[model samples]
Target: MERFFTLLLILVLSCGLAQAQQKHSISGKVTDNTGEALTGANVYINGTTIGTATNAKGEFTLKNITAGNYQICASFSGFKRYRENIELNASIQNLEMSMEESTGTLGEVVVTGTGTPHHLKTAPVPTELLNSQMIESAAAPDFINLMGSVSPSFDFSPNTMGSFMQLNGLGNDFIVILIDGRRVYGDMGGMNDLGRINPNNIERVEVVKGASSALYGSDAIAGVINIITKKSKRSISANHNTQYGTYNTYQSTTNIDFNSKIVSGHTTFSQSKTDGWQNSPYEVDGDELVETDEMTQNAYLRRNVRQDLEFRISDKLSIYGGGSYYMNDNKRALSVKDYGLFFEDFSYNAGAKYLLSKSSNITFDYTSDTYKYYYKYNQTKEGKYEAGDYQLNSDQRRDDYNLRWISKLGKHQTITLGSELVQEFYRSEGRLQHDEESVNTLSFYLQDEISLFDDLMLTAGLRVVKHDNFGTIATPKLSALYQLGHFNLRGTYSRGFKAPTLKEQYYYYEKRGTLYLGNTDLDPQKSNYYSAGVDYNNKWLSTNMSVYQNDVDGLIAYENTELLPGDADNGIKKRRQHFNIEEARTRGFDVMVDVKLPLGFSFGGGYSYVDAMNLTEDIRLDYVARHYGNVRVGYFHHWNNYHLNVQLLGRLQDDKYYHEEPNAKGYDLWKLTTTHQLLHSNKVNLKLTAGIDNVFDYVDDVPYGENRGTINPGRTYFVGVNINFAN
Candidate 1:
C-alpha cells in the first residue's frame, strides 16, 4: 500500500510540473490608448529578473513562469504607467493588455518607413515625425511651403511653376518620396518639386535625413520623405477645412466617411489657388532688373481628390484601396525666358490582405501612376527664335506591385518576407526629349527578430535588389536592444544602395548653348550607416539622444558634355554629364525630450544637428541647414459644455547653402493654435490656428539661376479654421 501511494504521488508531481510549465508562459501584445501597437515596451513581474521587451511587431512572450497570481507592469515612454493583476491558470496561454497615452502627452510615436513603427524613446535612427495637428497649426500655403514652419533642415523656395523644396544640398532627384510605403516619383525638368503634393490629404509626414538606400533603395541618397494618408474610423463622421490668406490664396478641404458591417470608406477633396508673388524686376537684393530680362507675377493653382475604401469579405480577409488625382498649373522664370507649365497626374492603388492563421498574415498591393506635362512659352529676348509660341508635352507612367508575408514562428522568433516589382515608361516631345525607357526592378527582403533572453532582443534583416542597369546588390541590417531597469540602449548598423535614375541615364539637355550627354556607364551609389542611442521613459517623462553616420561611395558628379550643337570646345556653356565621385559622408546627432507635467499640461522639443557635405568639392551641400529644432507647450481642459485647448510653437533653423552657394542665415518662427468644443446634441467642433512665419521678417538673398538672386518672402501671417459634424 505505501509503495502504491509513493507511485501515485510521483505521478501527481509530474503532472503538476507539466501544468506549471504551461501556466508560466504567457504571450501577447500591448497596445496604446489609441489602439495602435506599442513597440519596445517592457513587461515584467515585480521583484523578479523575469521581463521581456516588446518586439518591433509589438509582441512579447514570457517563458518558464511560475504558476501563480502575479502583478504585471507594462511601461513605455510618453505614456502613463500601466500595472495590472493577471491570474495564471493551468490552461492559460496568452494575455493582451492596452496602455493609454499619458494625458497631455505631446510627443507621440513616429513611423519612418522602415517597414515598422517605433517610439522616439527607443528608436535607433534619427527621424522626425509630424502629425496633422502640427501641420494644421502651421497653416502654410501648401505642403512644401509649410516647410518654413515644420522642419528647418529643408529650405523651400516657392516657384510659380511648381512647389519647390530642396532636401539638404542634394537635387530633387536624390530624394526619395513615398506615400504609405509606396514610392511616388513626380518630376518636372529633372526636379520632383514638393509643391506638387497637396497637404490636405496627408495624415502624417515622416522625415529621415542622410542616406537611406538600405531600406528604400535608390533616390534616397539625400533623404527619405514618407507621407501617410488618413483612414476612416467608425467614430469619425465628417470634417471640413478652409483657409483664405494673402496673394489671393484660398484653400478648401473636405472629408466624409461612412461605415457598415461589410463596407467602409472615406472621400476627400481639396482645391487651392494663389496669385503668387512678383517675379519680375527680380535681381540680387531686389535692386534693379537687367535689360533684355523680364519677370512677371505668376499664379499657382491645384485641384486634388482622394478616396479610400475598406471592405471586409470575411473574418480573415479584407481589401483596402485608395486613388488620387492631382492637377497643377504654374510658371517658371529664367533670364530672358518665362514659361507657363502645367502638370496633371492620376494614381490608383489597390491592396488585399488575408489572415492565414492566428499568427500569420499576407498582403498584396498594386499601384499605377501617370504624369502628363505641358509647357507654353515665348522668349523674353529679341531673337529670330524657332518654334515661336511653342507648346511642348510629355508623359511618364509607373506601375508598382508588392507582396508581403508576416509570421510569428513561436515565442522566440518572428519573420517577414516581401517582394516588389516596378516598371517605368517615359515619352516626350521637345528640344530635349527621350524615347520610352523601361526599367525593371525586382527586390526581396527577409527580417527576423530573435529573443535571446529576458532583457535582450536582436533584429536582423537582409534585402537584395536587382536592376537592369546596376545588376544585383545586397543590403543587410542588424540591431540590438538592451533593457536596464528604466533605461534602454540600442545600436544599429546597416548598408544602403541606390541605382541610377532614368534622368541620369538618358536625359539630354543644353545649358547655355552647351550640349550635355548621358552616361550609360555610371555605377550605383552605396553607403553604410551606423547609429547608437539611449532612451529613458517613465510615467512623467521620456527622453532620447542619438548619433549617426553615413559613409557613401560612387557618388555622382556632373562633367561638361563634349558634344554640343555649337561646338566651340571653349568648355563654357556646357551641359552636365554624370560621373562617379570618390567618396562622401554625412554625420548628425538628434536629441528629444518630453515632459508630462501636472494638470493636463505638457512640454516637448527636439534638436537635430547635421553636417552633410561633399568630399570631392570640399563644400557644404545647399539647402541642408546644419541645425533644426521645434518646441511646443500645450494645455487641455475638459468641460461639460465643451472642451478647450491651447498650444504654442517655437521653431528654429540654421543657415544653409543653395546648391553651390555659401549659406543662408538661419531664422526662428513662432505660432499659436486653439480649439473649442460645442453642440451637446450633434457632435460639433471648431479649431483655429494663428501662425507668424519668419517672426522677425528676416529677408534672405536666395540665389537663383546661374548667378542671379532673389529675396524670399518677408514675414507672413496665416489663419485656419476646421469644423467637424456628426450625427
Candidate 2:
C-alpha cells in the first residue's frame, strides 16, 4: 500500500511539472433576450469536460484552457442553447451571449441513468431531477424527507429501527445511494444514514428508477440516487445557516471555500439536535392499556464535518482528497430501559483524473468507511456506571477502489468502462457468534450511448460481478428514446442481481421472544425489470407518466423453522432463519403534471399507485402503500433588492400493509413555507425562512413496535437564516 501511494504521488507530480507551461482563460456573461442577467446558466467548451455555471451576477470564467479555437456553448432550462466559436492565443478572452425563451426541455442535463451525461430531452432513459430551489422550498431537514416531498415514486416512514424508504414499492435494501458518484457504505437495519448528508451543501439530486445494476452494482435493483454537491469558483467564499424549531430542535451548518488556478479547497461543518417527543404515554399490551417507557424520535443528536481539496495539475489532469466524520446519539426514556444507542462513522477518499483529450478522461478513486456502535448503560455499581462493561456492540468497515474511463467515440456515440473492488469486514459482540467476518466483491461494467437517427437514441450496458462466496453473475440493460415535436417516448428493460449481505449470512440474535439465525447457503436474489414513460414539455405545461414492473426470484426472507442441528438454549419460543424461499413482483404507475400559471405562480402535483405482492405466499408485501400522492403550489416575487417566495405542500397516502402487524391508517399532511431574501448584492447575501409542518397537528399514537400511519410530532414551527459572502 505504501509503494502504491508513493507511485501515485510521483506520477501526479511529474504530470504537473511537465504540463506547467502556458495556459489561457475565458470569461463571459450570459443574459436573456430582454438583457436580464441569467443566473445558474451552464457554459462549457463544446465536447469537453471544461465547464462552469454562471454566478449570481451572470458572470463565469473558465481557467486553464489550452490555447486553441473551440466552440463555447451556453444553456439553461426553458431556453434555447447558444453556441459560438472563439480563438485563444495566450491571452484572456471575454465574450457576451444572450438566449431566448423556448418551449422545450432540451437544455436540462442528467448523468445517473446511463453513467454518462446527456440532455434530459434526448436521454434514452427516464430520470427525475430536483434542483436546489425546489429542495429549499420544501424546507426538509434531511435527504429522505426531501426526496419524499418532491417525487411521487418515493416514500419514507420513521421508526426505531430507522427511516424506512420505499422506491416504487421496493425497500431500501434494493436502492443504491451515491454522494458525488461514490457509494455510501454504512447501514443499520437496511437503512443508510440519510442524516449524514447536509442539505445546504447539495446543488442537485438525480433519480433513476428501475434496475440500474448494469451501471452500478448490487442494491441497485430498485433505483439509484446521485447527490451532487456545490463547488466554488471564486477566490474565497463562505456561508453560514442556522435553524431553530419546536421541541427545542436546532440545526446549524457552516461552509468555507478557497479556489485558485492550481488548487481549490472546501470545508463544511454541521450539527443537529432535538429534545425528542412522544405522541402517547400508553400502549395496548394484549387487551389493557399499559404505561409506555420509550420516547419517539425520528432522530436525536447528530454532528458531521467534512473537508476536500483539489489540485488542478493542468488543463488535462487533476487530483483530489477528502475526509468526513459523523456521530449520532439516541437516548431512550428514563423509565425502565437502562441503555441507549450511539453511532459513529469515519470516511476518507482520494482520487485522480487524467483528461486524455477534450472528449475523454480516466479516473481512479479509493475510499474507506468505518462504522461503530456503542451501548450506554445508565446503571451504577460501586460508585461508577456499568457502561464500561458492555460499551462496544458492533464495528464494521469497508474499503472500495474504482477506476473508470469515458471516451467519446465520435459525434454520435460515447462509451464508458469502469471497474470496482470492495472489501468489507464486520465484528459484533451481540449480533454474531464469531469474532469477525469478511467479504469481497469485484465487478466490471461497460456502457454505450449512440445517437441512432436524427431524433432517436439507444443505450446499452452490461456488468459482470465476482463475489467470493457466490461465484460470478452478469447483468445487462437496454433502453431507447424517440423525440417527437413536443414529446419524448422512452422504454427500458434490465436484469438485476443482489448478493446476500454479510449480516444476513452470519447474524445471530434474540429479540421480543423470537430467535433469529442467518443461513450461509443462501442464493442471490435475481430480478427482471421493465419500464416505459412519456414526457411532454411546452411553454406553460410539463407532464410525465411512467409504468414499471419488476419480477424477482429467490427473494430473501425470514421464516419460522424447527431448531437447528446444534442449537443452544436461549429464552425464546420461536426460531427463525433467513432463507431464499420467496418470489415477488411489484408493479406501479406514476403520473405527474406541472403547470406555470400567471403572475409568477406555479402549481404541480403527482400520484403513484403500486401493487407489490408475494407470488409464492399469495400476500401483499409489507410496509407498502397502494396509493400515495403530493401537491405543491408556489408564488415568487422579485424586486430591485430582494425576493419573496411562498409555498404550500401537501401529501396523502392510503393504508400501509404489514404481515405480522395490523394495517396502518391512511393520513394527510400539510406544510407551509415562506422565504424572504434580505440582501442580494454581488458579494453578500442574506435570507430568512419560516415554515409550519403538520399544520393540522395530526399524530399517530400507536405503540413503538407497530406500524405508524404518520410519525410527525404534531404541529411544529421553525425559522431559519442563511448568510453568504464571497470575494
Candidate 3:
C-alpha cells in the first residue's frame, strides 16, 4: 500500500509539470451600480478554487493563468453576483465589473447530487437548498433545529439513546453528513451529534434525497446533507458573534482570517452552554416495558476549535491542511448516581489539488478522526478512580486516503474517477467481548456527464467496493434532465449498499439494564431508489414537486432471542440479539413553492407525505412521522447604510409511529426573528438580531415514559450581536 501511494504521487507531479505552459495574469476592479469602489469584495474564476479579495483600491489580480476561455465571477454580501466570460490569450491590464444590489438565492450554485457543480435549477437530481439568507432569517441555535424548521422532509425527536433523526423515513444509519465534501464521522448510538458543526459559520446547506451511493459511497441510501462553510477572502478579516437566550443558554463564535501572496489561514472557536429544562419527572422501577428518566433533558456544555491553512503553489498546484478539537460534557443531575457523560473528538485532514487546465483537475486527500466516550464521576468513589475521574467506555477511529482525477473528454462530456482506501478501528474497555477490532476496505468509482444539447444532459456512474469481511459489492445510477423555457424535468434511478459495522458484528453491551449481543452472520443491507421531479423557475415565482420510493432488503435490527445451554456466560434473561428483517420500504412525495410579493415581501412553504413500512411484519417503521409541513414569510427593506429584515417560520407534523415504544403526538411550533444592519461598509459591519421561539408557549408535557414530539420548554426570547472588520 505504501509503495502504491508513492508511485501515484510521482505520476501526479509528473503530469502537472509536463502540462506547464505560458502564464498570463488578469487584473480587474469591482464596483457598485453607482460606480463606487466595492472594496473587500471577492473575485475568482468560476468552477475553480483560485480566488482573491479586492484591496482598498477595489483592484484584484490573479496570476499564473494559462491561455484559455474562462468565466470570472465576483461576489459581495449585499450585491448581486457578477459573472462574465473572457478569453485570456494575453495578459489583460484592466477589466471593470459593475454589480447590482439584491439578495436572492434562486441563481445560487449547488453541487451535492453529483460530484460536479451545477446551478440549483439545472441539477439533474431534485435538490433542496438552504442558503445563507434563509439561515440568517431562521436564526436557529444548532444544525438539528435548523433542519427541523427549514426542511419539511426532515424529522427529529429526542431519545434516551440519542436524538432520533430521519430523512423521509430512513434513520441515521442510512444517511451521511459531509462538511465541504468531506465526511465528518460515523454515528454513535444510531444517531449523530450534529452539534459538532458550527451553525454560525455555515454558508449553505444542500440536501439531495434518495440513494447516492454511486457517487458518495456507503451510508447514502437515505440522502446526503452537505454543509458548505464560509470562506473570508481578505488581507485580514475578523468576526465575532454572541447570543443569549432562555434556559440560561449562551453561545459564542469567533473567527479570524488572514491571507498573503501565497498563503491563506482560517481559525474558528465556538462554545455553547445550556441549563436544560424538563416538563415531566418520572422513573421506571422494574418489570416494565417502558424506559423513563428522572429528567426529560440533560444540561450540556460543548466547545470546539478549528484551524485551516492553504498554500497556493503557483496556482497550478495547491495543498491544504486543517485540524479540529471538540469536547462535550453532559450533566445528568440525579440523586442516586452522581455521574455524567463525557465526549472528546480530534480530527485532521490534508489534501492537494493539481489543475490540468481550466476545465479539469486532480485531487489527493487524507483524513483521520478519533472519538472517545467516557463516564465522569462527580464525587469521590472507592474504585480505581477519584472525583472528576474519567472511565473510558468506547473509542473509535477512522482513516481514509483518497485520490481522484477529473478531465474533460471533449466539448460535450466530462469524466471523473477516484479510488479510496479506508481503515476503521474500534476499542472498548468493557462493552465488547473482544478488546479491539478493525476493518479495511478499498473502493473505486467512475462517473460521466454528457451535455447532449444546450438544455439537456445525462449522467451515469458506478462504484465497486471490496470489504475484508463482506467481500465485494457494486452500485450504479443513471439520471437525466431536460429543460424547456422555464420548466425542468428530471429523473433518476440508483442502488445503495451498506456493510455491517464492527459494533453490530462483534460487540456486546448493557443498555437500560439489558444485555445486547452482536451477530457475526448478519447480512449486508441493500436498497433500490427511484425518483422523478419537475421544477419551474422564473423572476417572481419558483415551485418544485418530487416523488421518490426506496426498497431495502436484509435490514438489520435487534430482537429477543433465547439462549442455548452452551451460552452460559451469555445470560438468558433480559437479552437481545441482532437479526435481519428481510424486506422494508419507504415512499414519499414533497411539494414546495416560493413567490415574491409586492412591498418587499416573500412567502414560501413546503409539504411532505411519507409512508414507511416493514413488509415482513406489515407494520410502520419506528419513530417515523407520516406527514409534515412548513411555512416561511419574510420582509426586507434597505435605505442609506442600513438594511432590515423580519422573518417568521412555522412547522407542523403528524403523529409518529413506533412498534415497541409509546407513539409521539404531533405538534406545532413557530418562531419570529428580526435582523438589523446597523452599519454596512467595505471596512467594517455590525448586525443585531432578536427572536422569539415557540411563540404559542407550546410544550410537550407528556410523561417521561412516553415519546414527545419536541422538547421545547415554551416561549423563549433571545438577542444576538455580530461585528465584522476587514481591510
Candidate 4:
C-alpha cells in the first residue's frame, strides 16, 4: 500500500508540471516587396512537429513550441528564404518575416501533364513555374494580365469577354487547361478566356512548353497549363483585398479557410468590374473601314464563388470535393461602336477524389458551363442599313469522369494507369436554333517511369481513345533524361490531336434572311511533336532551353465558294467551309536564364521564337506571334524587412490582320515596386508600385488597309498596405 501511494503521488506531480506553461506559441506574417501575402511559404523549426503554414492572410501560427532559443525559417518560390533566431517566451511571441525576390532556385516543382511531378531541373519536359512573386510583379487585374508577366512564351489578349493564351505560336485551341490536375473546359468561344479564372484563388501555374498529349489527349498539341489552387492549411483563416486601378476598373476578393487533421474546407468570393476606354480619335484618318465616331471599350463585370471540402476518413483513405459558381456580364463594341455586344455566362463544377492506397489514388470530376450572347444595333445615318442586329445564344455543356491509379511498385519503378470518359454537347439559337451534338470520348492510358541507372531515367506512355466524331485515335510518347555532372539533357517525342469545334460541324444561321450553312463532314486534326532540351544548375546560375518541331495534318481553312445567295434582297451569307490541308509545320526555340548576383540581387529572363506556316496557304498562320521575351530583377533584405523589384515584358509579330492587328514590333514594358517595414513593429508593411505599359507609348500603323493604328495602355500605378494580427 505504501508503494502504490508513492506511485500515485509521482503521477500527480507529473500532471501538475504538465499543467504549467512549459511551451509557448509563435506566429506572424510574410509579405513581398509589393506587400502581397505570399502563400506556399514554408515555415518550420529545426526539428519539431510544431510548424505551420501561413494562412491566406500570410499569418502563421505555431503551437506547443518549447520555450527556448530556436531558429525559424520561411521560404517561397522565386524568392529568397528567410532564417532568424528568436527567443521564445512564456507568453505568445511574434516572429515576422519578409522575403525578397530572387532568381535562385525559385524552389519550384512542376506538374507537366501526365500526372508526373518533378523538380524543375529534373523534369523530362521543359516546364515553367510562376509563383506568387512573379504574379505580383505584373500587377495584373486578372489571370490574363498575370500571364504577360510570368510566361515568356505565352500571348494573352484579355478583352471584356474573356482572355485567350497562345504558346509557341500555336492556336489557342491547341493547348490544354487544368485546375489542380483536373480538366477545366473553358467557354465555347474560340479562346479559353483565362480572365474568367480568379487569380486570388490560385497558388501557382505550371506550364509545359511542348506537346503533352501523352496524358492530356486532344487540345494538347501545343502545350499544357495547370493552375494549382490554394489548399487548406490553417485552423481558421480569412482574407480580403480591394483594388482601384486606372480606367475606372475595380477588383475585390475575399476568402475564408479552415483546416485541421480530420476536416478542412475553404470558401472564396470575388468581383471585378471595368468601365472600358475609348479610341475614336486614333481611327480618324484614311480607310472607309475606320469610323471617326468609333468609340469602344471592352467593359465587363464578373463574380465567382467557390467552396472546397476535404475529409480524412482514415490513415490510408481520404476524400475531397469542391464546387464553384462563376458568372460574367460582358459588353463589347463589336461590328459597330455603341452597338453593344452583350454576353452572360454561367458555369459550375463539382469533383471528388479518393485515396486508394499510400501510393495510389482515384478521382471523379465533372463541370458544366452555359452561356449566351445578345447584340443590339442602333440606327446608322447611312440608309444602307449595314448595321445588322442579331441575338446569338449558345449552350455548351461537358461532363467528364476519370479514374487514375498510381503505384510505386519498386525503388526504381513508378507506374500510372488512367481512364477517362467525356461527353460534350453544344447547341446554338439565333435566327434559327441549331440541333445539339453529343461527342463522347473514352480514353485509356498507361505510363511507366523507370530509373534506368543512377543518373539516367526513362519515361514511356501510350494513350488510346475512341471518340464519336473521330473514331479511334492512338498517341504514344517516349522521353529520357540523362544527368551528366552539373548538366541534364532531355529528349522527348509525342503525338497529339485536336477535335473539331461544334461550330465547324453543325452550325447554321439566317442573317437578314440569308441562310448560312455548316459542314456536316469534318475531320479531327492530328500532330506529331518532338522536343530536345537541356538544363544546367549551379550555385549562382541556372539555365534551360528547348528546341521543338510539330508536324500537323488536316489543317482547317475557310475557302471562297461559288454558291451564291438565292434571295437577292438579303445580304450574302459569308460561307466558311471546312476542308483539310495536306500538311502544316511549326518549329520553335525557347531559352531561360536565372542569375543570382552579389549583394542580395537576382535576375532572370526568358525568350521564345516560333515560325509556323501552312503548306496550302504558304503563309504564316493568323494570330501567331513570332517572338516573345520577359525579364525581372529584384533586391531582398530580410533582416530589414525591405525589398525592391523591376520587371520588363516584350512581344513582337510582324504579320497583321483584323484578327492579328495587335501584332507589332516588339515593345517593352517596365514596372517597379518596393516595400518598407514599419519602424515601430513588423506587423504593418507599406508597398509602392508603378509601371509603364508600352513605356514608349509608340503608335504604329495598324493593318487597317489605310487607316492609322491605335495605341496600347500608357502608364499605371498602385500602392498597397498589408497588416497581420495574430497570436
Q: Compare the candidates by TM-score and give the number of the best one.
A: 3
lDDT of 2 by residue, 320-426 (tens): 99999998876766574666767889999998887777778777788999988776675656655665344777788998887788899877999989888889999
Output the number of the lDDT-best candidate. Answer: 3
lDDT of 3 by residue, 214-284 (tens): 56785588999899887789899999988889988778899999988689999999998888777766555
Residue pairs in candidate 1 whose N, alpha carbon or C atoms collide under 3 angstroms? 160-331, 161-331, 163-195, 168-624, 169-622, 214-496, 280-295, 622-657, 623-657
RMSD of each: 11.5, 2.9, 2.7, 10.4
TM-scores for candidates 1 onward, in order: 0.77, 0.93, 0.94, 0.79
Clash statistics: count for each candidate: 9, 0, 0, 1
Residue 445 C-alpha lDDT in model 1: 82
lDDT minimum window of 10 residues, candidate 1? 12-21
From the highest lDDT down, the ranking of the candidates is 3, 2, 1, 4
Candidate 1 lDDT by residue in tens digits, 616-679? 8776654567778878787778778676666676777766555744455666666565555443
Against the hidden true structure, what lDDT does model 3 obtain?
Answer: 0.83
lDDT of each: 0.65, 0.81, 0.83, 0.64
- Model 1 / residue 496 / CA error / Å: 1.3
